[model samples]
Every structure is written in structure tokens, then in C-alpha cells.
Target: MKISKQLNKLKNLNVEAEKCSTREEAKKIINKANKAQSKINK
Candidate 1:
């Protein structure tokens, strides 16, 4: 359940990041997502 929930959250984040018009904005979103994902791994 937790893994599925995290995957769903990541999917939503990717969708939202794709909507970003600028590279900087997309990078920020990706970095934030990576940080959150790393925490889960730890």
C-alpha cells in the first residue's frame, strides 16, 4: 500500500512537472521529487 501510494504521488508529480513551461521549474520539481524518494529509500 505504501509503495503504491508513493508511486501514485510520484506519477502526479511528474505530470505536474511536465506542465512546467521552464527548464528551471521542471528541474526544481524533479530535484524535490528525488529528495523525497531518497528519504523513502533510506
Candidate 2:
């Protein structure tokens, strides 16, 4: 995937994480974002 697209997804994940009420939900989003960031780094 493109870097820009990955970045956008990461940004969205961060927003979702911030809005999430549960710690588990936020952790999941953060994990997803971290994976996306790793993919971008590759």
C-alpha cells in the first residue's frame, strides 16, 4: 500500500483510539496503528 494511505489510516486509528471509551478498544486501535506503521517502515 501507499505511504500516504497508510498514514491516513494511522491518523484515523489514532482518532478512533482517542474517541474510544474502553481501554481494550483503544489498545486494539493502537496495535493496529503500530502494525500499519511497521508496514510503512518496511
How many backbone clashes are present in model 2? 0
In candidate 2, where is summed lDDT lowest over 10 consecutive residues? 10-19
Give TM per candidate. Answer: 0.63, 0.85
Ten contiguous residues minimizing lDDT sum, candidate 1: 1-10
Q: Tens-digit lDDT track for model 2 on 1-42?
A: 899999999989978987899989978998899999998999
lDDT by residue (1-42, candidate 1, tens digit) is 466666777888899887999999988889878976875676
For every candidate, C-alpha RMSD to the true structure in Å: 2.3, 0.8
Q: What is the lDDT of candidate 1?
A: 0.80
| Global CA lDDT computed for model 2 | 0.91
- On a 0 to 100 scale, what is the lDDT of residue 34 in model 2? 90
Residue ranges of candidate 2 with Cα displaced over 4 Å: none
